[model samples]
Target chain A: MRTMRLNMQNVCLTMVLSLIALGGCDRQATVSTTSVGAASGAPDAAPARKLRIGVSIPAADHGWTAGVNWWAKHASQLYPNVDWSIVSALNPEKQVADIEDLMVKGVDGLVILATESAPLTPVARKAHERGVFIVNVDRGFLEPVADIFIEGDNKAFGRKSAEFIVEKLGGKGSVAILEGIPCTVNTDRVEAAMAVFARHPEIKVLGRQPAMWNRQKALEVTENMLQQYPKIDCLWASDDDMALGAMQAVKEAGRDKEMFIFPGAGMKDVVKMVMDKDPLIPANITYPPSMIATGMHLCVSVLSGEREKIMQYMPRHLMIDVELITPENAKQYYFPDSIY
Target chain B: MRQASTRVLSLTAGGWAPAAALILVITLGFVFHGDRAYFNWNTHRDAMRQASVYGILACGMTAVILAGGIDLSVGSVLALVSVAFSMMSLHRQDSAAMTIPAALMIGAACGGVSGALIAFGRIQPFIVTLAMMVAARGLAKALCGGVKVSRYIQDADGRYIALPVPEAFSRIDARLLGGNIAVVTVIFLACVLVCHVALTRTTWGRRVYALGGNEEASRLSGVPTRMMKVSVYALSGACAAVAGICQAAQLQQGDPEDGAGYELSAIAMVVIGGTRLSGGRGGIGLTLIGVLIVGYIEKILSINNVPEYARLMFTGAIILAAVLLQRRWHPDSEGRG
Candidate 1:
């Protein structure tokens, strides 16, 4: 028992020492970067220092968020004048801590894609009060803390997809819905889709099952749904990943000929399927992950562009247009290299 | 003679507990099945397929449990191996012969380290495995750069090229036995068979149960208790690796977040199978029953279109009921079994 206690103490001590060493390295890196910026500013003989923008986003927990991370990095790389510090947090508390650290690091602006709206609003509001320019992306804050808010139209994503499904089915076929994780994004999309389905009294809604925006779970659920409903005419898979999974199940059960799938979120693979005129994936709705790139672009414009001219043109709230991706227009939205 | 007869009676009762829970769950399915979908062979086959991954993990969990240890890192290790296999096969274009063994080694190494820490360092199994869980997930994210590793690869001039998926992926995901069973299901059953034999027929198996039943006595009797613990965890890790490979094949991508929270389900399967958490008291046969019960419940709710919140509540209720049923045989034979 005594030896075990000693061993535990030794392990704890090593962990603490390594943590302190990591902190030291981080501080040194920050100091060096600031010194480099100072040296560059000296040569310009201008009063302006380098613009440091901190980008805080939820960590890439799924395909869509992974695309967000990729786009954010791609946008950051496009601007060399701005010093970009991108931090991804797994949850709201960690995101709050990251924003606080960015604030302490003295960023001129912040581009935030919150993990959750409520828990992150206060910190964003605090940053706003401290005079930091805030550009909030999808999943907006609870309060009006952002200087500019940009979000995709999830309700339209649902309504548009549902309308397309109805029109193709001639307003009479039975449909099943594969839902995403229960959140505002999911709720808005599902409720809107249900409203559209309600208008078509002839359309029999088989059921809606939450596949949690996962490919494996969607495949499993769709397989079981295939066995339950002998003839499903259309499947409204709310996300691209789930759409692909459902498509697989449909193909496996030899029912791809019987139904068409409409998935939102504009995943490149699904868009490609649409481009190829795949029988199963007939259309998709855009809830683009590139919205984060748009948010980053706006932040850079505000911080680096002529302030008066840009402010005159820019709006406080920007809703990126969501469109339908079908065979006719799938090429325009196809991002072959995107991680999503 | 009376005492011996009672012991035999309680053992049989304990053995039958898991099967009873399974029947009860099946009855619920019959009562509220989605328009008789539960009666279909395809539904049962698909349920088995869905349960296979968790079943594979539970195989290792059963072994570790019998040796008086718990492995919470299986889920994260599964994620890590999935990512590793995807990166190798999809991006690096490595053959399955190369990727499979490498992924298995990575998972075994993860489990071996946790086992060593528990056995040699005398840290609690829960804490060690928990630490392994968090660290493995982080490693998975780092390895895949926080994105799923799929078949789309970027070439020079920044254009994406679609590569043909490796043959091994589709093969592992294919249905077999005249399309009645998934390949992954076969792999799961093979794992159960191997674990069952390892736990029942071998002298090493006896040592493991003895170690769980009384560690000091096992050690005094010349059993290599420390090595036994380490091997048990390594076996669990290998099982997780196999599960990861199966997951990547079925999803056709290597998702770093694939197996998040799956450890809880694997643990639940073991416990509901009449396996005592205090250890030294379960078999792979019982775990197989537990897997089916859990799988059918999930399938029934899904086909019935039960909302997400209700599915969660029903799962919790069923787990508690099954465990309570299993507990009935415990008090009578608490002194010895």
Candidate 2:
């Protein structure tokens, strides 16, 4: 009987602690709402009921994802007529749970940048069935469950970057590739680049390694690659952060003069390097994380009763164009203040 | 078969196990030279440099494990300090002299909190450190606004200005000893030396082993077991801070998400060093061999350009093989940690 009483007390204590935690979250939400409210004029300033939109994206584990998160928050603050709740998750399970909670809150729309495509498809399909308008960004769901899908052309990102490398090497020098994590994006980009490399008979492809889209990992991998291959004329790091890291490794080896690096994703820092015409980084390709902001714009327009106006320019599947950022045109794509 | 295996383990018993494991792993390099990449001295130097951060963490981990505790918070503390150090060094333009001590203090405070919970609150080390791990990551993210703290700082006019890489950062990342050894590798060795002395020559160190061996007896013997627990964790935290500074220097940024899963590597290094996980028998010397063992295996695989999946499997297999080969069931293994 005494043990049972102690167990009951423990359970009660846990309940109180959880309640306090939840209360803290509530207060935080209220504070953000008021601040946003003040930023967009005053309370009840313009609308009868603000459309509630939920933004779910993976947590910023790297530079590109960090940019995605920043853009998502920035977009939320831009639209005054919509109440936005942004939740970033570290893994797919937490993302699924967060989406379910957003669904329970009866969000009018969801702007989802899924951590992974496979596991998020069913929950997204469920949300679609429940009449929540969906805007899927970057990573797509397995099923066509979203009202709109906005994605960057990762294949183009690889193709253009590879072509530039081939041209710069005069179609004969030995080149290498550094890949990101194994996912749809990585597969598409790497396979596309390999196809391009195969067409050029004179270009000797040294090898490729997955750096997992991390700077330190890329630096370490590049250090070993430099040692493994005595001469690499050109190198392609598929992401901007990896490019930065590989550049560091090359500099450390005192081999920066031997080859140039080509990287995708127009991170502001990388763009600046291009703008300054750094010998190591001659150019970059674009895979903008601002596609999240575009997704948010679509979500707001459709839910704000402007579906017809947006439909004139938007289709069910919107594939954004990927472009190269060279020294001559890098300034156009560079946003210095934005965090990537 | 059991008796034969037991005899083999006995032959590699005591500190000889980790050394044997190191030799065996190094022999793998001889078998597959990775197109002669393994023969290059620079490759070996880079391996040492790459392993330095994990080595530093393992140094502190040696202390915590010796005291019968685990700190999952080390990685998070590392991220926290990295972010803190980056913000001060890059955004605020603080000198290394100013930032290093502040970062170490932040890391120690984090570790001190977890220690207090475990010591005074009577919570499990795993649970307390786990909570601290989550809280520290959240704090790191909050502090940095979920972005990397890099050289790009926003001016008052909202224009992004590229600040020069701080002198302290470049110096830390630079090579020393005529480019033969990285400064970070030297720092890691210094940490190992400190932990070695603290574990081998000090009374507090003896009390830590006693606590891990049998907590109840240590407390009864007036060991001040609680204070020792707190101090060891703080030491581990300080080591993690040093690693964080190294990481930020190497990356040239303070990423809040850095060191996300490094605690496992630190733990693996300790365990592979023939340190029993139940806590009461290992030294910093074994950990050094473990560091080289793990480091060289990775360098060999990398120079070979082993595919990611194969690399993962090989790393797992090698770590397990090393630990199993070193597993001993000696009767006199109870007195030391």
Interface root-mean-square deviation, each candidate: 22.5, 22.9
Per-model lDDT: 0.80, 0.80
Off by over 4 Å in 1: A1-340, B1-12, B154-161, B332-337
Q: Tell me the tens digit of each residue's lDDT in model 1 across B166-207.
A: 887889978887978889999999999998888777877777
Residue A154, candidate 1: Cα error in Å is: 11
TM-score (second chain) of model 2: 0.92
Residue A126 of model 1: what lDDT?
Answer: 74
- CAPRI level of candidate 1: incorrect
Error of 1 at A39 (Å): 79
lDDT of 2 by residue, B19-58 (tens): 7557756776665554344676666777788789999999
Candidate 2 lDDT score at position A262: 90
Worst 10 residues of 1 chain A by lDDT: A15-24
